[model samples]
Target: MLLQLDIFNILIQGGKGLKPLAYRMRPQKIEDIVGQQHLVGPGKIIDRMVKARLLSSMILYGPPGTGKTSIASAIAGSTKYAFRTLNAATDSKKDLEIVAEEAKMSGTVVLMLDEIHRLTKPKQDFLLPHLEKGSIILIGATTENPYISINPAIRSRTQIYEVKPLTEEDIKQAIDRALADTENGLGKMNIELSSEAMTHLTQATHGDLRSTLNALELAAKSTAPDTKDGKVHIDLAIVEECLQKKALVQDKDGDAHYDVISAFQKSIRGSDTDAALHYLARLLEAGDLISVNRRLLTIAYEDVGLANPAAAARTVSAVTAAEKIGLPEARIPLANAVIELSISPKSNSAISAIDAAIADVRQGNYGDVPDTLKDAHYKGAEKLGHGTDYKFPHDFPHDWVKQTYLPAKIKERQYYHAKENGRIEQAFKKQYDLLRQAQRK
Candidate 1:
């Protein structure tokens, strides 16, 4: 009868018995929350807002599991404001209006939008009027940069709070808390985590609290049941088995992406084919197709221009091919193009010369475009003698003419410095020298 009673209790409890502990263990109050002391710690912006009961619409920008949602929930729990949660991934503009209407009827409504960056421009525009009127206090959480992802109009209205990742120490403390809190944690299992295991788990988690807790739960459950040891021991080997695969690689979203691409560009510029290929592979593998293409196109113009003009042509062809073929197979043509570009002799000051000339114009360092070069197509343009003295280069020898092209303020400005290493550039150098000598005579 006693044995039957024991089996019945186990059946009744089941997985629900263990899951509640995990759910209930979530920090109920902001004070109990781990990490993010910068925002939630005493005297911080969020801390002051909660304490003063003066909440406003804001954006929470950070990586995953950084307590963005949790902080929003904590605010809802502690305040008199009505909290409405919606995911931007699937939530529609109609849904937002519904929430706005609710706020109109009720008191202050805190609308928490998760993955807010995913919201389309039209959908984002829906919230603008309500945000302007302060009808609903929006709390938007996203992993991407709010500046890049959020509409400028919407961004202008919201205060952006940046959240940092949890530290290794913070992760360790969270693990210990999970083990000690029996109600919603591993405390009931009497698990004893070795220093080696603890270090492994902490380092492996990469400052994500949710992942660390989940790993701990898995390790604890995998322990041998027959062991007479009063305390459940988790070792490094056990942790390795539990984790199995390596942790996902971290991506630095904005400037870091550009920085990596820049490195790859410079490698190709310096003719370091190995380094260029490595960076290309890294970006391709990481799903930076648009970025890779942008750099490749730039390389085509700025590094391979004229010297081996085919290099630029090949890059464009490769990009077109990749667009049509897409991944795996596309990688091959892209790789071949990159290799050809790295080996090609290079020259490219054309764009830079134009850029400098434009800068001079913007600074008012130059006058109008030479009257000779102004458009003669317009009716009045010809009357103004726009093309009066224009020398058509094609009508002259070598499709070149020795004439003043710069404006009066910067007539002597030297641009288009030719690189002499490539045959195309060497020809250009010889032509330019001859033109200058003729002009001098």
Candidate 2:
């Protein structure tokens, strides 16, 4: 037991010896944490919890490098809890069993479960009982939404806190801390980062502190020292070369994926052409052509139904052209389709009419089909008085005939109410009103 304790201490205290700068610069205490001020600032719930040593099981959710794991480690440091880290993707259920056993022996254990959304059902089942008994203080970290991706049973037992992306100043603060700290940072070595380099690095990382630190470390390590002063000078050129290109933070299967698509559909539905095109660009940049295509097609039928029926055919053509040409070129046709849909007159009457009719049917309002409208082409259908009084519209002027198409119970029921959203629907509405007037006459 003493040997195990010694090993644990070594693992926790081994930050100074050779390790990644990001890992070494991890905040050891709550005050050292750079971002997430909402949860951990003075008088905040997490801060109060840590100060009082009354931490609870929590799942920290956010984008990558937003300090979920670091916050958990900080909590363990501040609360003096026995902290054990495990990778939910690689670690098996047996590892959790071991942690639970350790918690029993140690009285309490703060288990930092990284990528916890990947944890299997059996593993989660194992942890729940322990979580209820207060034996395991689980800190589940996930980049995806806990409500969407996490097991409901597990999520219900943990308080979920969303860790927001770090701001430029917050990231700069972290960069400065890493550069000046003599113990874990590169302060011993003389390194001067230019103002332009600082701005470029901070902005290029897109609020990801881990990427910023890693880029700083790369800039410091890769650059040769000046011969005269023996100091490393990181300029814009050096930072740019080290950082490469900025990456878009989009998860193909996560909340970001749904968010962009949702915004795209809403933009088109709301008739914001600029917003629609902007979201379309985002989807194209993220290489999510399928969602772009599927959503545009849905908008045509769902939002623009009957108002501009031609838009549906045009959208299908656009999708086919995009699929055939395949990206880069595909974005052109897709953009055209998005613009057309956004500007088209919007109406939902077709869908609403069908839905209202279906509701009445579901409520047991349906009756037998009218004899005139029933199938009359069969040999014995005529004997059943089907189509006996049916009037062919071809025999009447304007191909119009007013007759009871619905059952006697709902003979006067009207479902479709056309809107004058476009010229096509306007003409239909005019003809509909004339037909009703003629029927009254």
Candidate 3:
């Protein structure tokens, strides 16, 4: 009992002592949490779960600095569970075994696993039984999407929730909490942050609360108090010194990756050069050249199809060059491809026409092949009237004789609705219409 009391005292003292500001100011309760309103706001899913003490195996996925681990910790605190933390990058199977053993003795253990995506397959397999038996309520936290990075067996056992970046107001509330709470924050310190300093840190961190807190801590700890007032004044200059260039929130393997690629293709289709280039740069910076190549080729064929065949051909060449040259230098050719495709005339008619025909076929609309259209190369094909009405188009002017090519059911169905966007497709529309007219006559 004395030993337990001593450990508890030490924990209490630690919160008031030399822990980093970010560590000290972590929310201990759900209400104390400053962001992730969608998860913890009034009547939110997480709020209800924690309130009912019904914590289960959950995977929290989001960008860095979005309180995933903190929320897990808060849930454990709220539910009065024995909290245990582990880093999948460093902890091994033995560590998991120890945690599971402890949970067997304790009522419940809230195991918050950081970078759960990095958990080895063996370790994840080991954790499966513990999770099923409820010995440990696993709270897996990762910046990567669990569906993509986690083993299927493990992902199937957990509920996945996405925690997005905090809003500016939420971040500000967090900062205020840190400054006002004397027990676990910088409230005890005589420090005053200028308005400009607040704005600088808030804007520069780009919704990353950890980054904001760390910068605030650095400026607080390093700056000396003014001799006149005996208070540390954190100004814009100090903020500038502490703030580094923050990259945009991007998950190369998660939903953001697909979202960015989708936007890039749409931008090209809509002829928005600037937006297309922006998304191109994002992919390049993330070193996702493979996705870049695939998305660019898809855009070329799907969006730029039939409208500008030259652009389509050029996009293929650019992808080849990108593959040959590789990144850093490769982004140049990729950017050129994106720009060219963005400005090129857009057309979905070709794909739409094929898809319409395919849909009909899928719905049991298969029609018999026209006797004239059927091949007569077989020994007995002539006896079946296969080539009886077949016209040799080469024997006519323009190598174009009116003939029934389509299946009889869809022979006259207008499938190809050409959009007059570019010169090539325009010329194609005229010639194609003339051919249809000739066949009707």
Candidate 4:
């Protein structure tokens, strides 16, 4: 096996670096890993295997940037094994033979086979004997569900474990590590990442650690140091530029930032087409396409709600279309949605009702689920009085039954107070009033 390249030192010594911050900052030991405590935490499955020196061929499947490759690296680091990587999808059978030959001679080489589900039959045949003999410890990494995507032949020989998406804290921890490690990170530089910038990084990528680190690195390099402080102050703008999404002219979470979004939503809720269009243009001009989609969707269900169900549905379609095509052209569908939502009948009945119910739940003004509404599938369910006297609504003439589904204490509590904003809502209110009267009686 070839020696692992030290791209970090190469860059410091005036060489063109090849490896990314994510690859360079990979955990050298299992303990150094940021997250996935269920597998890599102290005395966890992977940890136990590493500590006992009894590593087995295993499949790690999960979303990308969730540390599947990092797990393989950490295992190799912990075990002091010769680690070699090859893409099963692109690499040929000859590549597998080379790794196998090395494993035979080198003793227990860790072969991190990427896209393991894409391993062709010929390559699988070549690699199986080596895996069976315990010469090569196969660490198969893939994004697909192994049970469904992987061949049974490979599945039978490997223990499968999921690598879950990183939590916000996990991504933050990794970022801190990369920013602090002088040998492999940007520790030498005077860089200060702002709080809102950090939040943007953590939330915008949706639990992707790789994207966060890379974005951070990009911000650090691209942003110039402050003349007065001599610190590279990476704020939301620089971070957004690095992300290529989440654009903000005003500092994120600032008064002006909140004001713009607040006014945008309120204008739509107030049914002012001109004002809504103006705010929409401001947001679009600032290049915050994501924020536009989010607020519009919220307004669809929250503001335009049950008053015009079809209009709200159309708003969703508009948002989806805008997201696919993006801005300039996205402005068209977004404008159409704005106009329809502004001119259409509006209602806050659904949002108000749900919020009221949520408040009660939060206050602990509830009780245990009634036995009549409890599951009766199990053998002892009837003995426990579960499903006892439970009426099947479908068996009734109107497909309706006068039975409480809520917990005992909250049986009479109403959550959905329908409005008379539109014909549909009026009809719903009529049905709801009738149902409540019968049930209460």
- In order of appearance, the predictions have TM-scores of 0.52, 0.59, 0.61, 0.66
lDDT of 1: 0.76
Ranked by TM-score, top first: 4, 3, 2, 1
lDDT of 3 by residue, 315-427 (tens): 99999999878878998888889999988888888899999888888998878998998889989998999978899989999898877887878777887998898999999
Query: Which model scores highest in TM-score?
Result: 4
**Residue 17, model 1: Cα distance from true site in angstroms:** 10
TM-score of 2: 0.59
In the range 1-441, model 4's lDDT, one tens digit per residue, is: 111334354334445655678888988789998889999998899999999999999999986798988999999999999999999989988888898888878888999999999998988888888888999999999988899899999998899999987876898888888888888898987889888887777766656788888878767766667889888898887787778766443554544555788889999889899999998887887666777888999998898899888988898999989976876899999999999888888899989998999999899998998889889999999899999889999999899988887888888788888878789889889988998898889
Candidate 1 lDDT trough over 10 residues, lowest sum? 245-254
Residue 228: error of model 3 in Å? 2.6
| Tens-digit per-residue lDDT, 1-441, candidate 1 | 011224323423654554532344567667877888998899998888988988878999986766787788777777767888899999888999899789889967889899988888877778888887877889999987898888777788889999887777888888889898867777788787777777766655456676667667766765643357676778767765665533222222223445778888998988899999998887776455656787899998987887777678889999989866767678888898889889888776677777887887688787678888888987888789898889889998778776767676676777677777688778988887787777646
CA lDDT, every prediction?
Answer: 0.76, 0.83, 0.82, 0.85
lDDT of 2 by residue, 1-441 (tens): 011223223333455446667888988789989989999999998999998888789999987888988998899888888999999999999899899889989999999999999998888888899999988999999987799889989988999999998876898899888889999898987989887777766655656788778778777766778888898888777776667742232332234556878999999999999999999988777555767888888999889877899998999999989977877899999998999999999888889889989998999888899899888898998899998899999999988877877777876777888898888889888988888767656
Predict model 3's lDDT versus the native. Answer: 0.82
Q: What is the C-alpha RMSD of each candidate to the true structure, in Å?
A: 10.5, 14.2, 11.9, 6.9
Q: Which segments of model 3 are wrong by more than 4 Å?
A: 1-17, 246-338, 341-441
Preferred candidate (TM-score higher): 1 or 4: 4
Go through the candidates in order and give the clash count of each: 1, 0, 0, 0
Better of 1 and 2 by lDDT: 2
Clash tally for model 4: 0
Which residue runs does candidate 1 get wrong by more than 4 Å?
1-25, 101-106, 245-441
Please list all clashing residue pairs in model 4, or write none if there are none. none
